[model samples]
Target: MKNGAFGRDLLVKALYGSFKKLNPLDLWHNPVMFSVELGAIVLTVEFVLEALGYKKGVLWFTGWTTFWLWLTVLLSNFAESLSEIRGKARAESLKSYKTAVMAKKLREPLPDSPYDTVSSTDLRKGDLVLVEEGDIIPGDGEIVEGAALVNEAAVTGESAPVIREAGSDRNAVIGGTKVVAGRIVVKITANPGETFLDKMIGMIETAKRRKTPNERALEVLLVSLTAIFLVVVLNFRVLSEYLVRTTGRGEPASITILMALFVCLAPTTIAALLPAIGIAGMDRLFRRNVVALSGRAIEAAGDVNVLLLDKTGTITLGNRMASEFIPVGNHTFEECVHTAMIASIADETPEGKSIMELAKKTLGVRSDALPKNVKVIPFTPETKMSGVEVDGHSYRKGAFSAVKEYILRIGGTLPPELERVVGRIAMSGATPLVVVKDKEVVGVVALKDVLKEGIKARLAKLRNMGIKSIMITGDNPLTASAIAKEAGVDDFVAEAKPEDKLNLVRDLQKQGYIVAMTGDGTNDAPALAQADVAVAMNAGTQAAREAANLIDLDSDPSKLLDIVEVGKSMLITRGALTTFSIANDIAKYFVIVPSAVSPIFPHLDKLNILRLEDPYVAVLSAVIFNALIIPALTPLALKGAFYRAVAPDKLFVYNLLIYGVGGVIAPFVAIKLIYHLIEFFVG
Candidate 1:
């Protein structure tokens, strides 16, 4: 109940659901609980027989045993029901944001095309919708034309507006977010009920959630233990009859007592809370604004040994800004800044925008209006440069080699200090973009991309936990090495392409490494699919989201660290509770086994370390204790166990002393105290 707290209505619904789960058909999935229910029914019949004067034991004893047995099953049901109710409540809240809105449906993919106004719910895949400023996006889609500043607080919970533009990796947009500035034509990618929000809501609902691989395997172990314990308890009746004949003392174990012993010996504590633990793990991730398509992804995160991260937007601030304008030869700083700003007038990349901002702030230069006969050259992979031609002069800024070749071809000599200046910038982890006007070398703009704060510290923690961190980037070797050293990553791949990432993941997997890849682009889909744990950004392309199992709504690639912690916490909680549950039987055995046989073999009473005076009270007390512990530990199951970064060997020893030893001692004290209270009341 951290983010999705239970309200009065949710609590009432959960209470009702607990009773509804009492149906045998519903309990059938959990074999241990189902067997407990069967035992409760048998005890109820035995209590009625005692009341009708067929008396095999005291009527009050039989009645109390039956009541406790039923309560045990009910508490188990309530734990699971409460977890499911919280999940549904979160789903309802997500649904509230997806209200109907009118969309301007475009007949053609043109800015001024004929359009029809239709409800957002009627939107279909591949439909083009024209959205303007102040209009809410009708559905999840990619911007096909133009760009806008969108407020996506409805889904991401971040109030800052993000820029979504056509022909860029950041073009994807979710429905229910308003277009706060500019206009865009969006091409719908999902049908009305198949949007990202719809998929998230469906995945969180209890009925639709599939059991994770770990959950299924644990359930099998619990069922097998239940079967093994059932055989041991059933054999107790034969042993009791033999003892009665040999000593001519005591009665054969009654059905009520046999049922009580069987329930206590079985691993009921872990089984009762297993489903709740799995549901709570999903709820925790949802609270962090991450939606996991399957529980297996989260479980895999706990075991990941290698993390592959994209360099830009993940490790670094991503937007390279002009930090310095170093002039070459006799050119002044103002001349270099003016040339760079003029060359980037028709550019729209983040680096270009930053250059214009730097120029304006430094020298108050403005290029708001271009001359009527101006011609622009856009940057492309082949050209590696962008520039504009006006008044019979060409201004350009790009990679040093590209700009050098342009000036050389135009019959100009290179500046004497240009090479040294560029090398200094590259060595300092900044990209040096050469600026040239006509046939003369102007200067270089040092576009520096800074590392995200605390990234080095986070990677160091991952290293301590035995997870290797690798950075992948399209930058040259010099820049890549500088950033890798600055971020403290274990390894790096320079000048990497889409297939390079895919091949790296496959190679790491072949070496028996569990790789976790975080990416947010259409080019990242192949690698995301190949990695063991794939986390895609929600703002990424549809292909990336579809390929990855985990989607980060806030689009922060560093969130993978939090995901790993949550996964480890869930696994640790389940393992600790299981250790405690099995250890608990030690105390129950001392309370019930010795008391059951002590009537015929009085020497066996020495095993009753708590020194209970009444056999009937001892058995009843153990049954009540077993029932009460389910609700007592419900909060721990939902909240998860305490976790820290420690060696596996040390962790095992620590848990053994805490939960394992504590579990053995807690029941002895509780059962003895309960027996005394019951005896005083009966007397």
Candidate 2:
């Protein structure tokens, strides 16, 4: 409702010369409907009395009618104030969308979405583009050229720069990722509308739509409880009328007065409490840098026991560096580096650039020559490798799987020892690149991204907190498990596609586990949306930024623990206020009922229950008490107050005791004081 109303307001503000005369108050949001509803109810009651031949004096009816009208107006104003706060908070939660536009300063190229690349302005689908060290990726794609350390925390919830090298099966680049080191060429597989970043942001924007069972149940309870209270109050009025008719006395002035008080105190006071508390809780979260897209997510975050995570950027260092150079073709490491450099001179992949950088570092050689008269076949998903021809000699380099297929097509097989060596490297989470020259396998280079600092210790901390951390990835099982064990992950899923990641979250939710998936790239969008909580990286892809609820402004995986703490604290705070408000109301009923009915407390009944005779005094007292006493006694609502006399779990019981037990004593004391005051005045 908040979003819809805000959206309507936005439309109105944007459209000129339409509904220009209509004030915001003229809309259904004003207090007018509440006043009309209350007035109609009062009139209906008067009509019912007249039909039963029990017409009251004009002053009695007029006073009672006027009181209800004002009561409804007051309640409506309170409701609207809360609603406005919520609307503003909801609008602010989406401030990141504006940031996306600011990201345009990076002048990132658009991926092939609108379908024209020459203009660079018209980024068509399936175009391979390059992102330099200082440039941002314009679209989401697989890294095809150059190895780079990319900060993707904005796109993925995890605050980490992921390293991408060629031939790393899990490597995927997202749009808006800042190239921290090296350069990369990305093959744009998804168009702008279909990009991962867009989907993630869309998910975040829609976060408020989902609701948990508890919140729904609470809503039902509020409605039903308010109705029950109203019925009881009405029944008491009927009983008073019955007593008056049986005694053959004039209708009791006090009964009508009590009815007016009940009307003002019952629905206005109690029903107002529920939504006010909820909106206040939301505002508190907003102030705490927590963007709660939905009440369900906020509630779910408090209940999450096991938080499943993705490994690539979540638990381990996401960047892989070129670490080893092994030569097998009667060639020294220098010779191999030279040959590889020549082969990759015209290449633009991250792994190629990493290899080139290694050659420069090791041999201190620099050359900017692309072999003349060269024919190149760019790597495609089907081929899984790329090849270049220079002076009628063809050289190929790519994944072991692709190389093996090429060898078989030519009726050749690798030596058993060589295959075993590659297998061992692959098992250790390394990408094996088999270099082939003149259709004969020459050597292989194995590379892996190093792990992040203190990841194992962090995983241990998660375990200590009783959180079962699971790693999900698209890597082969051997590679996935190797990284998982090294990172101290409790469980893992390998070779999972994007949709599979999302489905896995759903499955975990069905089993009653709260899941959180972190990805700084476009591919992580769906899974981020699927989870109960979506954490996006401050440096991650546009899709991820759009999809998540919470952004790791620092792009660090460790931030999850901090967010969990914040969410837990927020729930505790909400529980605190809920207990206090309900308890106070319950106590009021006990004290006010006994005090008003006691024969010895005639003065208690004579005193204006709501001080309606003087509207300013009554309203001021109610407002001040609501703003000060109730809020102050609401132990949880107290500013910066933590763990006082009561633990979080015991708060509800404490509040009930104060309101129930203390309430009985409170009214008796008040009545006694009133009697004494009246006697002294008479004396």
Candidate 3:
């Protein structure tokens, strides 16, 4: 109670102080309600009665104070209007934030509804849900039953649909995908808060908070300039008072000068310049189709270096189908096809799905129905493969290393014919998965993955821009190396886990590289968060987006490069404007001071035929010159005013030359032009 009472007293005192600072008479809307007007009328009456010196009456004092007060009121009103604009923008920002928070809250607790529920709100982690032809999958999941081709472009940024089936290991199932053919059951694993969509939103929010170096530098400069402006005002006020005291008569001359000084050093230009440029730049970014969310994110994008890309969705086509199938073993090719078909029916890998599809096409058998009494083990990254069981005997299939190791443990060797087929497949950049039944070799499944179009040209462009491209993948070394070489990447990190991707990013950073990670999956989330600037596909998982610093709405790598150029140019323009403005100010001090001290420079002080104050003429001349020249140079700060596609180093040189030469020469030209105008007006 005591603390509350004390706080109330403090608040009252502060309000009282503010009231005292502002004149009450100025707050009144009616001019007649002013105390100064009443005082002036009273002075006239007092002069008539006492016949005192007119200057000693209330009229002179009241009239002078009233004029100053009216100016002060006008300035206060302007200040109030500006504050309201700021308040409105702030309120709108708050509304956006509240809406985002509400959306995020809704995403936290997932529903445990039955598998029949297809709504995202009713989905839970690890629930097997059914999806049929032309139906949208409502949650991220894996194909658990049957085979279907799905269009996942909305989630993975891939243009083509992917074929999915049971036992397709580590394949990501996205929300809002349409099954083009066949009926399938998906096992939901990523629920509301943990989903890719949620993460993407979170990444965008984080990007808004990250400050750019240019922004930070500007903030510091603004604070220092504000402090300097305050000091100058205080000094002018003190000088006015000192001059008044030195004079024998106690006149109100000091107050008039104080009013003029306040108007002079309020930093009107600075206040208007900063936010205008920032808002203009932000608007330009949006118009260019870049999702910059905030000024700070745009600035940070200028310096991104190492771009850690997700292999499946970001580099190669996420969709994989069986292009070729090579078989080997003592068993007949028909028996081999039947065993491979049965095993692939229960598997859920890109390779697995392709094999199953080829089997159905070749054998002319329906895959929608599964045989009874079959045991399935889903493929995991750690296990490197997966398989199925029938009649108490395990039929395993996976990576060559995994199959070979298992075969060795069980005291078996790859049949000579199977080894030759596997060798031929490996040479052609195809992964060979060996199928075995009861420790006897069945056949080899050759799977082919297609490369993304124009990837080579994109890498070449990066190299031309002096950026090194690196490829990292969890695929076997042989496959990864082959793909990397084909893509013409500068470096290749093969057999990498998600953690390895993160470590690589950290290592690059330690080596003084600016890292950027682009991924559309949960595994890419951690590395994206750790990168200097992370970009995620708009269709990526919520986690991946949340971890990223930028969002590519269309998931175009080319767009990222464009944003970097724009952001860098923005910083350059800011620096250029600052140099130009400050240099003009310095030159003004030299040009105006000599005229202000003309009394001390009698030789240079020449009164024209009009006989006006030489000092005033000089100040007017300089001001007129500044007004015309400043506007002419404004194009330098405006977007797209200079070079559009110049090299960075050359752009810097050009700007320095242009602004440097222009800043110096433009003022003198303005001064000469203004002098001629004054001569024409006065002569």
Q: Give candidate 1's error at residue 467 in angstroms.
A: 1.5
TM-score of each candidate?
A: 0.89, 0.51, 0.52
TM accuracy, model 2? 0.51
Q: Show where candidate 1 strays beyond 4 Å.
A: 1-8, 321-397, 406-417, 435-445, 679-683
Which candidate has the highest TM-score of all?
1
True lDDT of residue 499, candidate 1:
92
Please write out the lDDT profile of model 2 over residues 448-490, one tens digit for every residue.
Answer: 7567788787677666655677888778999888888888889
Which pairs of residues clash in candidate 1, taking residues 3 or more apart in a chain or in different chains?
A: none
| Residue-level lDDT tens digits of model 3 in 159-230 | 677666665332445666667887776667676666545543443333233345675566566556655754
Clashes of 1: 0
Task: Give Cα distance to truth, residue 554, candidate 2, Å.
Answer: 4.6
Predicted model with the maximum lDDT: 1
Error of 3 at 521 (Å): 1.9
Q: Sorted by TM-score, highest first, which candidate order results?
A: 1, 3, 2
Answer with 1 or 3, whichever has the higher lDDT: 1
